[model samples]
Target: MTDFDTGIGDLAERLVTATRTGDHDYVADVLAKLAADDPRTRASALLRDLVDTGAGMIRARTREDNDALYTFDVTTEHDEPVHVDIVPPAPRAALRALAASLNRDAVDRDIHAVLATRGTPDEVVTVLVQCLLWTLELRDTRTPAVRLNCF
Candidate 1:
């Protein structure tokens, strides 16, 4: 049997309430609650989305020889395979597009789309963490590690 068959329904409902509040801490807290009540898978997925969606700060920003660069990575307890290309400081329009894409894609698919998209490493990491928290609260999953790579 799956945790989804047990108290997941009530937990999911509460998660909706938390999200509607638009309070990051609330969302994260409720997510943690859900994890405690449910399975570890939910926690994993939640953490992945949080890190991928910037639902929390997951990206890294630094100046290298006066040149700014971004680094990002994705990991899954499900062990989902990813080969992501490094994205630099893209144009404002590009970043906006990425954000729009992430929001739309994350609505149902969670942070999968955001994890797949290329953006500033810092932004990517942050989104993943935020979305992961939301995902766990709204659903249930495992928490994966943050993988970083530079090119």
Candidate 2:
């Protein structure tokens, strides 16, 4: 894996641990770090996109029951949002889906080709729509109280 992949994987692992223990503090710390570094300006941009797209502050849980799985609770700044299951780690199926998703004829193949080669977590998110897509799907399936929806 590339450095970006490694970093994201590590962060994902931390997220998982935090969830298993129900440690919101750890989740906040991770978010804060991402917010502080603002690597590739992804953290804030992602947050903005989430809010604009109707997603709210997300609380993620990396469950002990499954290694390749994660769950998120999307709550607003004041209201409780919803829970969304996610697999932050790149799995074969997700990759295949990602390859297909990025295969749109209207899209700039050159950009995604470069992004795939570069292999940064931020780039992966951009290319695969991983986090955002996963959040939306999981929320709908898992929670009924949530009113937010995005594609």
Candidate 3:
């Protein structure tokens, strides 16, 4: 994995642990780090609201045929549930090659095309973080499927 992937994975793990333990300060810290960019800023805002409202149960599942597509479910204190499906960009190697070979506009267009089937920025990011966490958990446990009951 690239440094970017490693960083995101670490952040995903930390966010999961913090949320599970009800560590609001740590969650805020993670959200602050994630809010550095535009889309992530919006995503972090949504996560902050959800965490504050005690909606920390994040579950992720990958399709049997396609590991690239992930489904996430989160339920709030009031029992309001939010679901999102996210298909992350191309593989890191492919994306890196595209970035190196193409212009900024072309790279943007390609990425946009890959992400066109998503939901809001917040939902996408939220689901992505959960998905990353699930992958890491799967790796550690060697399980066929993992359910993150880390509320």
Candidate 4:
């Protein structure tokens, strides 16, 4: 089942509660809660983590110089084989888009149009990730790693 089953409102309530704790492990605990028995939920959480990490880098103005990129296998909507090789300094928009896709209200009308056009929520997320992946796939250099699985 997707987070639609779990309810985004409940997730937001938990997140608000977690942030109030001001503890470092709050994110991990919340992620564990979201990851319960659902691979897509875990994948969504992982993508959110990547976006958060990239936002941190943007805030710190840090640029990594390395050749190691993180890779993950993603089964396409059509059951085709694919992989994502992520590098450091992930795009802020990509991360925000992933997060917004979950909440349903934060993303623009275009994303909503996907669902209105008969696309499932899961498929919308997969398409978002794949679009971001395609941009990264064209990148020849690499630094750092971020992995998330969606199948």
Every candidate's lDDT = 0.39, 0.38, 0.38, 0.38
Candidate 3 residue lDDT tens string, 1-151:
5323454445555666666667867665545444444444344333322322221221222233422323334444565673322223322212222232222234543343234213454435444344334434444453444334322
TM-score of each: 0.25, 0.29, 0.30, 0.27
- Clashing pairs for model 4 are none
Which TM-score value belongs to model 4? 0.27
Name the best candidate (by TM-score): 3
lDDT of 2 by residue, 86-130 (tens): 323222223323333323221332233333323444434442344
- Looking at candidate 1, the ten consecutive residues that score lowest on lDDT are 55-64
lDDT, residue 65, candidate 1:
31
Model 1: residues >4 Å from true position, as ranges? 1-6, 33-39, 44-84, 87-151
Models, CA RMSD each? 14.5, 13.4, 12.1, 12.9
Total backbone clashes of candidate 3, pairs 3 or more residues apart or in separate chains: 0
Model 2, position 86, has a per-residue lDDT of 39
Name the regions of candidate 2 deviating beyond 4 angstroms. Answer: 1-6, 38-151
| Candidate 4 residue lDDT tens string, 1-151 | 6433565445443443444455436544544443343334443443443333333333233344344222233445675664433321122234334434333333442332223222344443444344324323323224334333332
Rank list by TM-score: 3, 2, 4, 1
The count of backbone overlaps in candidate 2 is: 4
